[model samples]
Target: MPAEKINNSNQAVAHSFAFVACVTCAVSTAHAQSSVNLYGEIDAGLAYFSNIGGHASYQATSGLVDGSFWGLQGTEDLGNGNKAIFRLESGFSTTTGESLDDHPHYVGLANDSFGTLTLGHQYDLIHDYFAPFTLTGGAGGTAFAHPFDNDNANNTYLASNSVKYVSPTLSGFSAAALYAFSNDAGQFANNRLYNFAANYQNGPFTAGAAYLHANGRGNTAGGAFEPVLLPGANRDVFNASVAKQNTYATGASYVIGDLTLAAAWSRSTFSGVTDADSGAVEPSAGFSNYEVSGVYQLMPSLVLAAMYTYTKGSSAHWHQGGVQADYVFSKRADVYLEAVYQSASSGAPAIINSADPSSSRNQLLIGTGLRAHF
Candidate 1:
């Protein structure tokens, strides 16, 4: 009778194990149906400007090249090789929690295998790549940006009500297109912008081309800064008009061992009534900009970079140079020091000094900061 009882107990234990395995498999299958992720970065720094138009100041800032923000991204797997995806991102000041560009929230969606489409506040293609490769070092923050950031053309990165599409990679090549709406129903064309870009990467060589067009009103000016006052203009001729503008740029980069090299060129043209009335008497006035930069890794945790940029405006011209060094404390944190100097020619009014009535001037900046990611 005792041996019979032992055999019955063993059979019951085996049956219990089989039941647990079945339940585990079911839970795993359910989890595979959905996925969600959380991600973000926090970057802040202390900076000082020696001569901000004859004034010196100090402050703390965020998002030097990449803004600081937290976001959620997720996807739901529908059977038959299809999936639905979504993302919500927010940008805020690390020092004061103030939103950047008056926007605190952004959202978008896409398909799994097909190309992705997203609508919200986002960066144009030039800001996506060229800005970083140029004097701004791609960081729109106060530290690495170009002198007066005139070359940035007021984009500082990101636009409201932007819709973007990204194509899948084909042999290390991809393309993207974007459109931004002014969000005003009656003034459909006001502040509207469109951009397209193509890129290719193979081995240690990479190249890209991009185009941008903008039309409408408000502060969506085509240049880094508006032009200076003209001889015969009633209003502050410095203000850009609700006009049409077109821009194009191309760039390439190469990497060899510890050194990387890059170069880019861009042109912008402005037209319409405002431009004409403000002394752009001809069909339009434009500017051409060129940049070259390089980075060298001195150590596993240290990098040094330098860049030179030239802007030849149809109405003005300027030259700028910058140098920087960064030390990596870890993969997620780093400290950097940088300096930039800019000089204008007397041919026309200095573009960087539009606020002042000056034909030739020089400006300098120095800063140090820290950046972290999670």
Candidate 2:
């Protein structure tokens, strides 16, 4: 072949190779597109309690209203409107820098039309669906909780070894389901849990409900609901192992101009209760809670809220009332002040959600806190 012809052939081969490399790089960039984000929120404050184990107390507090937590969340675009997502969240005490519980630690897939599914440690249906209508970590946090948070209206627990599914919102409606494994051989039902929930929101109106069932809750370490429910000594819930627990809750809210009104109800039943250490079977117990709350947007960046709850139990009962004021300095920071009063039935100790039991049947708490998001 002539020299010119040979050079032309070599240049043709090089152009072909370059074209293939460019196409490969373009495809790789499209398919491998992904993103990850680190996110967190912190709440710290000081509180005064009128009665805690018989004495007035003042102390530093963390998560006085909203729990302090940090987490990472990410998503990878997978073609055809599908994506891969994951989140890992952990709670901690701001006062002492101690680690608390964890949640939403799972990986899953999401689609624009379908929805989301995740596996691992996560919240139950009640917290996802119904708790929003109450003051659960919203306008009023710890101050608005029911007696001992018996109904989990304040999100006191998380399930491990779990699988969760959430449906996409359609016409202002959504649904969810979750199941947690016991993870113990030969004991499939021990400490296992299943939950279902549905919610709807349309403009100024919103409604939701949820149901949760657990067998032998707090009975096994390798199961859901391992840690005891509350932090108080009053109803023995902190010291009791529930053989079976069932909770049902529903709520709704309506927004009118700058004021919002809300109402909610929940029932919790405990059967075959046993002492955690002594293993002594105790009588069955039940709790019914009814709550009404309202929030007023005093200004664009400031809000005032109030709530009242009445809890009736098989053995004891409580009445709780609270008020809160919050001012947002910016999109990432806020300050709040709250006051709460709780009174228990005769002969029953008053137990605030995040505070120790009062020696008598009445308790009061006043607090102020600041929260920042990043």
Candidate 3:
């Protein structure tokens, strides 16, 4: 063969090899930019309740300070400041291996400049924004949640068949909204919800406000609250003929040195209640909760916190107090002791964590637990 022909053939092969190398490099770079993470927390403890249906009991509990759960979350860079994100989280009873369902399971798209949009079962705006200041929110856990979790600051209910939007934080301000579809053909208002929230945070101060409205409680599978999300018999809290429900909440927290002080208020109303076997019989019943809480860093690794909540309803009232001592063993684990005391009047039963209602008007609970995050 001619030398010139050989040279031409070699050039053709070299060009093809170069193209393959460039393609492989591009694919590798894109793969490296995407990330998937498995993260979760587990909290287990032994608790003693001075009164549960008038009987004191000792039991092993899970998720005292934080719910025991695992999750898979991931993001893929789509370039141009846009990305795709998804999360699937589940809760479980650490002692009995019972799986808790109706958690957040969503996939969405996000952008640095635009925002985020997600679909599936997800949290309402109140849980995202205003709950942080409350004890039952991410800060204090279940032991400090409001009575019956009526305000939903502790995420007692999750919205299904929903769409959520979250705006990027601007100057320490962020906002979010959620809408859940009832999926009841021809019954548009049967168990639908609309929620919105906003938050602002600065050096030492943070504030949040949120609103939520649900139509036709107990009329759908899981619009706002349902028995599936709770233990047996605990469904009595919302098991009634309620035409509508609304909640408004606001809170503010200030940090000074190692101490943080916070206050929150919420008003919840159930309208058009019927003469059912459970729930209020009035046309409308309302509940208002006032809370004041504080967290102090006793040392670098030890912390002390307390909260006092006064709740008043149309027919009853309650006073609740909570205190906790936490010791950090490391960044991923900790141990804590917490207690809650409650007193109710006007024939209202003292209920803790939606467990059995106390036969009397007073109830007390103490628990010690270990928590780890990964």
Task: Report each candidate's C-alpha RMSD, comma-separated, in the order given.
Answer: 7.2, 3.7, 3.6
Candidate 3 per-residue lDDT, tens place, 241-324, comes to: 567888999999999999999999999888877644544464477889899999999999999999999989888999999999
TM-score of each: 0.75, 0.90, 0.90
Clashing pairs in 1: 64-139, 65-139, 132-137, 132-138, 150-224, 191-216
* Per-residue lDDT of model 1, residues 1-374, tens digit only: 69999999999999999999999998788678878788888877765554443565565756544567887878777676556667777778888888755222344555545677777766677766565455454432343443334334334445567788888778888899988886665776776778898888899998888888877534334322133222111233245454666778878889899988888788866666355244443345676878888888889999888878787777667787778888989988988887766677764433222123232466555667788877
**Winning model by lDDT:** 2
How many backbone clashes does every candidate have? 6, 0, 0
226-320 per-residue lDDT for model 2 (tens digits): 64644223444367788888999999999999999999999999887888888887788788999999999999999999999999999889999
* Model 1 ranges off by over 4 Å: 1-33, 64-66, 79-81, 102-113, 135-143, 146-157, 219-239, 273-285, 347-360
Residue 97 CA displacement from its true place in model 1, Å: 3.2
List of clashing residue pairs for candidate 2: none
lDDT of 3: 0.84
